[model samples]
Target: MKHIRNFCIIAHIDHGKSTLADRLLEFTSTVSERDAQAQVLDNMDIERERGITIKSHAIQMDYLLDGEKYVLNLIDTPGHVDFSYEVSRSIAACEGALLIVDSTQGIQAQTISNLYKAIEHDLHIIPVMNKMDLPNAMPDEVEDQILELIGGKREDIIHASGKTGMGIENILRAIVHDVPPPVGDSAKPLQCMIFDSVFNSFRGIIAYFKVVNGEIRKGDLVKFMATGKEYHADEVGVLRLEMEPRKMLGAGDVGYIISGIKTSKEVKVGDTITHVKGGCQNRVEGFEEVKPMVFAGVYPIDSDDYEDLRASMEKLQLNDASLTFEPESSAALGFGFRCGFLGMLHMEIIQERLEREFDMNVITTVPNVPYIVHTKKGEQVEVHNPSGLPEQTIIDWIDEPYIHAQIITKSEYIGQIMNLCLTKRGEMVKQEYLTADRVELSYNMPLAEIVFDFYDKLKSISKGYASFDYQPIGFKPAKLIKLDILLNGESVDALSTLIHFDNAQPLGRRMCEKLKELIPRQQFDIAIQAAIGSKIISRETVKAVRKDVTAKCYGGDISRKRKLLEKQKKGKKRMKQVGNVEVPQKAFMAVLKLD
Candidate 1:
């Protein structure tokens, strides 16, 4: 245990954390040169295609220094703000963290945010400046920023390039010299904290954990503290490039356990595992429960596949504990699950995974944040969907979730960024200079405002230089209204949304217009109307596919043509009253990308 070092990699998005990890693996010979690949930790196809890390990956490496063999357990964490929960989980199980910052970009929003999290955990931090080989790398400027952020000596910073494998040996030496080994007693009762888990068709559920105290062995009877279920360990192994079977895993070692647990609900991330006969008195204090930032309805295209979709989600949740869902029904879409996600990107990834991994075709409703509703009866209720809001008369007020947003960018883009936030009903909290050229702007904004296109717009306005990160700051009272979209005279519950009162009219107009372009024209005219309660806020019409009944009566008397037109108009009016509108899949997604 004294020679075992546990650490995780943390950084902002696109900071070369995974690439640096690849270098470390190669230097240690954990992965052969012939088989090694870029972003090897990002095993998912979507992650490779999009060039982002979505989940935390763990592996163990063996390093020899001064004729002594040391065990180094490394976890590669996601850099996106949407997957910050993964970083937190990774930090919880480690003794140290490698704070990787892009030299060219300096210290960005996530770099600071993740640093604070690691600091809170009392984990030893090793500041490493990555991407030093780039022609535009600003080592001197970024080193100053790192000193200001962490307040360490100038010599403490390590500069390296992940692409060229520069300073790989120095990094390894630092890990052995600076980061402390895991501390625990092998004689104590068995206790391991499960940091992550995944489902396999042949192996059931495989749980990855860091042993905190005592030791676990193969075929041992262990019980999960959270689920209170007992199972015999079918296999126990260390996480290497592959699962290396071990006779036993002592304290301070990271490994996996397969107990043949078939059900997803039986194993949970952050749960504790202990020997059933003489387990630890208290459960290991795992990380906090994940709080979902956005909510939406995910329905199977074919209603008959609802049960299959449910089963797939349960299995997926085993791999991703942050995802939460519950059964919900929609008047327009029928039976579905109301799923909660960490952000818009997280929601998109979940949708894509469901399609690719489970072969389920799903329609997702517009994403929204959970709102607290105070009623006239002195009751508080949480609303996730606009259609779930209480009657307007009974509702006293609504409180929307707010976040403390942190944006770091060059000084020149501050004005444009501020304008965009202000337009989203954000208030300036603080503005400070991180350095001579970089400024950090802090704001208090509604979570719903940034749910859709806020990140996209901020990137475009700053030319992809701004880095944004935010955390929930509780709820605040707001002048909010539920906007309902009606086709002809009937309301489409799936198209309804809860929005701020001031922006309701303009957004309603945009939504109606966007829907007009997406919804196909029918034999009868379709009246697309946006309404709030009894008052209609905006309206657009999809003209009917007219057959020109008067064409048949051409060259006849004017009265004959007029009679033909009148008959056709009456028939269209009757058709409009009875005809139902078919809302296309694109229309549901269009509302999210509305300008």
Candidate 2:
């Protein structure tokens, strides 16, 4: 155990965390030179194509230092804020972290957020500056920033370029010298923490865990502390690029256990596993459960695929514990599932995966944050859909979720960014200058405002130089009203949304116009209107398709042409009175993207 190092890499997005992991694997000879690939830990095709890590991966390496052998377990984590829950789980299983900062970009918003998480875990942090090979590398400035953030001496900071493999050896030596070895008691009863799990078609549920106390071996009976279900360990192994069977795993070692569990819900992440015989007197402390912040209803384009969608979601959820879903039905979209996700990006990734991996075409409604509705009878209910809200007469008031947001950007664009924030109903909390050219702005705002298109707009306003991060601050009182979109005369519940009363008219108007553009012309006139209860706030019209009713009366009298036109007009009027407007699926999605 003295020669074992358990650590992970944490950083902001695009900060070379994966690249550094690759170099470390290469330097330690974990993967052969001929078999090595870029972003080896990021095994997902989506991850490789997007050049980002979406899932946390663990690998074990054997490194020889000064003719002495040492075991190094490195877990690579996702950098996006949406995957913060995944990052926390990975951190809980390690004893130390490599805090990588891009020298050219200095410190980003996510960098500060992830650093706080590492500090919360009380892990030994080794701050390293990466991307030193870039021409615009500002190691000196970034090093000063790191010193201020971590309160370390200048000499303590390590410099490395993942592209050129510079200072890779020093990084390994620093990990062995600075990061402390995992401390646990082997004599105690078995205690392990399940940081991650994956479902295998033939092997069942494979749990990735770190042994916290005692030892676990094949055929040992283990019980999940949370679920209280017992299972025999079918296999025990360590991850070395791939799973390699091991006789047993001792305390402070990271490995995988095949428990023959069939479903992920049975072997959840952040659960404790211990010996069934009660050798250990206590359960390991697990991380807080992940709660999704965004909710959306996803339905198959074809109603017959509903069962297929459910099956696909179940399989996907086996690997992603953060995703939550339940049966939901829409008046217009038919039966489907209302899914919860960590954030917008997380939701997008899931939708993309369902389509790409499962071959299911799905239509998703506008994303919403859960709202607390106080009824006239003094009862409070949480509503995830606008249609689920109570009537206006029976509601006393409604509360919406808010977030404390942080923005880091160049000083020159602060004015534009602030204006954009103000339009989204963001209140300024504080603003300070990190440097003469860089500034950090803080705000308290509704989570709904930013979840839609706020990030895209912020990037456009700042010319792609601003970085943003936010955390939920809980529910707050708000004057919000539900805006319903009506096609012809019927309300489309799937298009209903809750908006602040002050901005309802303009947003409703924009939505109606967007719907008008998206909905195709029918045989009869179509009326697109946005309403709040009985009040019509905005309206747009799609005229009926015009046909050449008089074209067939060639060389006829003018009166004959008039009679033909009059008959056609009467037919349109009758059709408009009885015909129902058919709203295309694209219309529902277009209104949500209207901003």
Q: What's the count of clashing pairs in each model shown?
A: 0, 0
Off by over 4 Å in 2: 279-281, 555-580
For model 1, where is the 10-residue window of minimal lDDT? 548-557
RMSD (Cα, Å) of model 2: 1.8
Best-matching candidate per lDDT:
1
Give TM per candidate: 0.98, 0.96
Instruction: Supply the TM-score for candidate 2.
Output: 0.96
TM-score for candidate 1, please give it: 0.98
Q: Write the per-residue lDDT of candidate 2 for residues 215-257, one digit (tens) a residue.
A: 9999998898878899999999999998999999999999999
lDDT of each: 0.94, 0.90
Candidate 2, residue 541: lDDT = 95
Q: Pick the candidate with the highest TM-score.
A: 1
